[model samples]
Target chain A: MLEKANDWSDTFYDKWKPIAMGFVNGAEKCLQCGKCTGQCPAAAVNPSYNPRKIIYDLVNGNIKRVLSSVELWQCFFCSGCFATCPVDINFPFFVFMLRLGAMSQGFGWEDVKQLEKYAEKDYLQDGITVSPEERNPYVIEERGDIADIRQKAGMPRQREVSDEAIAEINMISDLSGMTNFMKKIGGVELYDCSKCTPKIEEKCKSKELPKKVGNVKTHYRFYNYGVPIGGADNA
Target chain B: MHKLDKLSGIREEIVADIPIPEEIFYFQSCVASNKYPGIESCTLDVLNKLGVKPFVSEDQTCCGGFVTFANVAAPTASMPAVARNISLAEEEGLDICAVCNGCWTFLNEFGHFMNGNDEVKESVNMMLNMMGREYKGESNIFHIGAMLYKLKDRIAENVERPLEGLKFATHYGCHYLGGGKYGAIDDAQHPSFIQELVEIMGGENVDYTASGECCGTGFTQVINDKEKSLDHSQMKLESVRDEADPDFVIVLCPYCLSQLDRMQQQLDYRRDVKLDIPIIHITQLAGLALGLPKERLAFDAHIGGQDRFKKALNKIGIDY
Candidate 1:
């Protein structure tokens, strides 16, 4: 665990506080109630993530741990906390704003950028967000199998998002700054320190970053129930 | 006009108990089209039976909910995209029936944002005007579940198979229930819309501990923290497995369907549990009740516990 000092100057609250003030009124009316955490699904699974504690941390200027913590990324955005908050605190919105602040510093979760390729492909391939083309060979094959099943059931074998819609999506994305945001955040430039050696900084410099941005810990496709139809026989 | 009035006006539309639209600008979900092809077709089929004409434009894009929720796309970008989508629907002069939960909620939230904030709406409209489109904020946004709830009586009267003897647990998809308090279909804290539908379809609606919990399709967790994401899903399923022991988990959103369907295999392998419960979308189940043929519903597209689901249907004496 990277030990971040609790210095307020080290936090991005200067930029974020204004946004929070606008939206949540600086959590000013927060009753120190633990209802947000109590109802939080993320906190239910991961004990470290507490919505109430996050608001407490923000109000107290202890934003260091809140910004850099992986727990920040763990929010399911279910808004269970938002719905349960006595003070009507919008915790999900707060988390989203906090994420933006963190991202402005290039310090938030980078894994979100993984979906950028899929969103880009949505424009080219019509509107299938997770097309078979982008998936691993196994997923592609599984998708083909599933399509075949649909076809056998007398359903249409083809479904494409509109080409015009894709054009519209591109134009809107470009016009609205989504495309640029994705490009900026999607680039892979971070080193997983957990994988670093004794000479961590030196090892990081020498290490070659993976070409694709993705979840390093999991396969591209969600786990399929059936036999592996593509890729290596063993895989 | 005050912003509060604008906000309340939008809220009034959302919470209004309006008649189901005769025609809808049916927005396609990228996830539904890819992950579960049946949801789209089944929805179309069910809507057709309900006497609703769905205008599925080839000129419509994904709602960009997943991308936005991933924090890869900011609202400044996505909100305009949403406004553009609405503008397209506005051009068609039809209210939007977002079949996916994520799309429904995000569009609703962005709709509120664009409506309440005049400056943002103006900028988005200015961008839309370039495309020869405009968003009036007059059209109502509805989730498919809400639409189904609206037509529950019609659905009940039309059931051909009558899913008696089948047990179902409803996963309303947190986006619609827990996304926010604004204009939810039913009581978010105790949503009974889908459960009511299950009963109308002649199936037993079972309630579990994590009924309102997320399926762990947490946009970020699905990308980076796969283990933690799967853990959250597993916990929900385990609660369902232990308490409800449902034959099939009913889902309104394709993403939630995928999470419940695809992750079951991972959970069974990881936790060494025998959860043979299958997951089906609400539209698919409704399609079944409406006497749609088995082949038309594309049951094989589902990933887990197909045999068990088939057997359950068999036990219910549903030949199709």
Candidate 2:
């Protein structure tokens, strides 16, 4: 069901190198520490996700393996993994990169497909799945039930951002190469997080995926603390 | 941790485990009396535990907050009306505790307004003068959430039972975690203060992603609209069910409790996804683990009932 190794003939090339640098910069808080691996609840349970190992992979230039690996999705992104890092490294953010990378290179569709379920239904009206960004802001402003209560208490009704605003926001997200890459790799529809299950594989497969968000290129940091290249793309 | 230390008082009661106020003023909310009485009962239960002795007074109406927060009535009318209520509390010489965030915010901000806006303050204090009541500009008013957090150490210290491994996530709601003007005991972004209370009592703090989102039960906003009303409530429920699925969800506000507990089940089928997460007042969960029976504790009144919290109660017993 999952793809194995793809052919890599220095496929990364010079084109993506500059864009990938932005990920390194955005990940400026990252310290080459293995602490995230030590503390991650998912990593604790699943030996497959060693954050340090992914960090090592990024440095190894193993973008292919990072592109296809399911390891990135396991992060809980509690920020605890980043909070405790001595160098202040945030591997969870790197996890966000792999999510895009997986979708970008048409890798890890299974997990990307799964994660997309959260945003699918509300994607049309509310925009985006997961209520926030692709990476972990770790900010949850409303839960389903509490939102239910606010209506009863007369919480001020907010109009869904106007179509103009939604389009502008998506235009901005498209500008972020990583976000566009995510849509492609996961085969996610341009605007939805639902229809992510394996049964909805048709919706999960998009041929004209926008791998590049706006002008910037989207890249995956498959090796979190370890390497992102260990999955199918690099195998 | 000094801010954390400001909280952490000892638990002096058993059954209600309600915080007992040596001097408390029952600063009521507009909705609680006619709408949600459980908030009153639950607050009383918590007050009783903390050894609080609340004094209820006469002629208390809306904290003038309902319309004020809603933007219907201007601060011109709201401020003076609130100061009158504070004067009543001051006459009793008690720290005011409103079960509603609106009451707490209005009371806290009324003094803030009195000091900040001289004309408004003078007018309010002037109104108090006519009634033979001086609005004591510096009266302490707090929500039940802040009071509970303050008693964390006390909660940790006394536990007839502690709920271990019982996953819980807290919904702070807006008034508690507003734009930061009202001030909350916990971090608005990653609030674990209440979760700490659950853990201290030996309960599991469920590591859910949507712990801090709005519960969209704005009493006035969705009165007429059907779709927005459902979206408002459904979104909050969807977020909590997003991850770290738990035995139960805890809330500090009554309106939040109603939406999550009562309305959620009704709307569950309409939702794209189904959640078994039961919502309860934070204090209610505390009372359950403290060895209170279903009657005094009143978990059966909830839709999913004690079964959601029953295991946690048993776990707390084993841990203690």
Top model number, lDDT: 1
| Per-candidate interface DockQ score | 0.35, 0.01
- What local lDDT score does residue B215 receive in model 1, on the 0 to 100 scale? 86
**Residue B23 error, candidate 1, Å:** 1.0
- Per-residue lDDT of A1-235 in model 2, one digit per residue for the tens? 0122133434432234343323223233456666666644444434566777666655556665665554654544334454456675545435544544454455444433333333223332243211312121111222223223323433222213346423432332343232333344344333333524454333332323333333333332232334222221111
Model 2 spans > 4 angstroms off: A1-235, B1-21, B30-36, B269-273, B300-320
Top candidate by TM-score: 1
> Once model 1 is optimally superposed onto the true structure by TM-score, how far is the C-alpha of residue B80 displaced, in angstroms?
1.0
Q: Backbone clash tally for model 2?
A: 94
Model 2 Cα shift for residue B175 (angstroms): 1.3
Q: Write candidate 1's Cα lDDT for A1-235 as tens digits.
A: 0112223462444445544325435475789889887777666666656777778777777676576555666688887777766667777888887776555444543455555666775643565566633243444544456567657756566675566767766788787776665655445655555664565343221223332443222111211112212211111
Candidate with top DockQ is 1
Each candidate structure's TM-score, on Cα atoms with residue i matched to residue i, is 0.84, 0.51
- Compose the digit string of candidate 1's lDDT tens values, residues B14-119: 5457567789988888767766777888888899999898888767777877767677666777777788788778877899898888888888888887788787
